[model samples]
Target: MSKARLLLATERRAIVGLAGLYATRMLGLFMVLPVLALNADHLAGATPLLVGLALGIYGLTQAVLQIPFGMLSDRVGRKPIIAAGLGLFLIGSVVAAQADTIAMMIAGRSLQGSGAVAAAIMALLADQTREQVRTAAMATIGLSIGVAFAVAMVLGPLISSHFGLAGVFYFTAMLAVLGLVVLWKLVPPAPRRRGHRDVGIDRGQLKSIIGRTDLWRMDASIFSLHLVLMAIFTAVPFRLVEAGIAEPRHGLVYLGVMGLSFVAMVPLVIVAEKRRKMKLMCLGAIGTITLSLLGLGVAGSGLVALVGWLFAFFTAFNLLEATLPSMISKLAPAGAKGTAMGVYSTSQFLGAFLGGVLGGFLSQQFGLSAVFLGVALLAAGWFVLMLGMTAPKHLSSEVVVLSDEHQGDALETLMARFADVAGVEDVMVVPEERTAYLKVDRSRLDTEALSRLTGVRD
Candidate 1:
């Protein structure tokens, strides 16, 4: 029978505390988005292009450093690495708060991005929970990020209206300190920490992971998604101003748009997952993004038009953001999920950096409307590429620890047996790790057969 395992008290604490820490850090990062372009005029040496650089400079550093930090945690320990990352974030926030020049702002933001502890944090969560409970823990963290983003969008403009840009940086600094407290005081220490194939990048898997065309398409999807996101923010604040919405009232506008978009997104997400229409939904969302951007380009100067397109843009954006991660999970090989995600994350950040650069360049060279049309063209191309991708089968991973008796030929025979079981898509057994990694179709998986096979003896 399929067994259900509940979380222990410590596990619950670990999940909640870690999710809070993740949310706090993200809140600090995203709060700068809506207000940075609006307030750039106050800084010496600010220009559209430079302002864009300041907007996305952190992504460059984050993309370069996140994987290494996660790998470092394997040697020194997760907590220390997390602490060090948060400290860097604290320092960056302080530097940014004092900045009077765009250059200084860029430097500070880069420091903020240098605190790339996502991989380490996930690894820590993996260590703290049992295999059965880890998925729930990860889901909590993901949900925390989404909530943080929604809150950040609303809070950023309000904070900026009251205390200006410096206050936003100061608030982020406070968030960093709060994250540190949560890390040490709230999250329970793991019994042990080690590299997890399912959760941490496996260097050996990179060649194969990157070699697959479908995975490449998935990576490109994230790249385009984030690129468009960063680029849109570079111009949206200006559009809001043109629409006669004062900077202070921008938060209310965002609050309304975000709330409506989130509500609109839920039913679409249900249709995508429950009805097995992810690919169709993904394509439709991308097409909607294209139409939204074009609509904004054509009519964004007017308030009603701007708000309407903003609603459309965010609805599509949220759907794509949620869908891509689930698709990545479904497409990844049994044991290479961590490596696949690592590459996917790096692509995401790089796209952010490029988005800022290119979006600003386009706006400076042509006009604000050009930025919208240009990104729309990019989305169109993305749609065409996706049309050819093979539909991904719904798949999930599971790990089953093996005993000494299941070694050599016995192990090979058991792996073969696992493949013969219904709904088992793929299986990779690492004798050294004494674990079997399975890619399964849960709707069709035979629970009794899997249980019997996993519990087999000589």
Candidate 2:
């Protein structure tokens, strides 16, 4: 039971390259969020409802296309689907950049989302990396998203202040081009194209995966998290301005809060992983977000209090953002990881869309404080959901190709043999797929012994 370097050089390159690719694109999308509501009035027909629509329209398209894109990648190659998605994103940025009306902006945002590449990207990452280190690789991508959001929050206002709204879209288009370059030059090709149920969507197993109450809980958590996030930003910038922070100086506040929250997030993540207290940490983070939103509802009138609550909000947001995907990877059924992730990603984008619409409507009809209180209720509901989730086991999923001779009665014998191996917890042998999925305690599992018994080379 010794720890060894899990990622090879190729694996390391793929992880970093894909993480950068994800971050670059996400930065483009998020750059408009912080300042858009503030500056949207300049565009033609830019009512509050239209402004919110522009902010959230991307998510609707993204949610619609996420699963199809992943399934397409399974048949076509990963790189091709990803490249096409980026092309759509690039075109959307250009359209949005040139738009004069809010309706046009929404159209561009929808096109931007038509390039739903998240599932394809994750599936490709799973394809290129080994099972043992896959969770860490996924974590790297998740952290990239969190960092991108933080950077975008600050950079959005600064960039928009300098270049105006159209300029921000132009810059976003440039990012899409850069992302294409990374995908082409940096990301390594998958070693071989084979079915990876753990990292890919399986149509046949979709029902089972979605029916799991635990997976539902995780999906709901992400939906709630992003919902609160989008809704808050809908009104937070205006609140900041009313409290005396000018639009141009909004970046400073974001920079400060993000920096401090990131510092706080790292330690909590470490403690959760090392102590195997994921459920506890998850619930606590949700509680923290709820408290932050409650504080915003009550105390957001003051500049200092607004910043204080934001700091707490982002700290919890960052922690949960990094934790949920890893938890999904761990808890998903062996052969349905991709389908599970596809659903998860869809829930996330849908939440973004709903949050924007709801937040804008509330702010327009009720007031800014009403938006905060509404999101606080969402956070509280998520906290209740988290309370019922079972703690995930510290285990990893592995797949082994079965030899032709190991069929029929031999397959049953093989399953029984692997079950006898120490630290092996669950085994499912699918003769049609000619593969075996195993959940094992990696720290104690003997890979060499299992390989010998299964006649599957590592």
Model 1 regions more than 4 Å off = 1-4, 403-410, 456-458
Tens-digit lDDT track of model 1 for 167-197: 9999999999999999999999767775578
Each prediction's TM-score versus the true structure: 0.97, 0.92
Candidates' C-alpha lDDT: 0.89, 0.87
Candidate 1: residue pairs that collide: none
For candidate 1, the TM-score is 0.97
Q: Candidate 2's residue-wise lDDT over 368-445, tens digit each?
A: 888889889888888887787899998777777776667765667878987988878788877777888888888889
Measured on C-alpha atoms, candidate 2 has an lDDT of 0.87
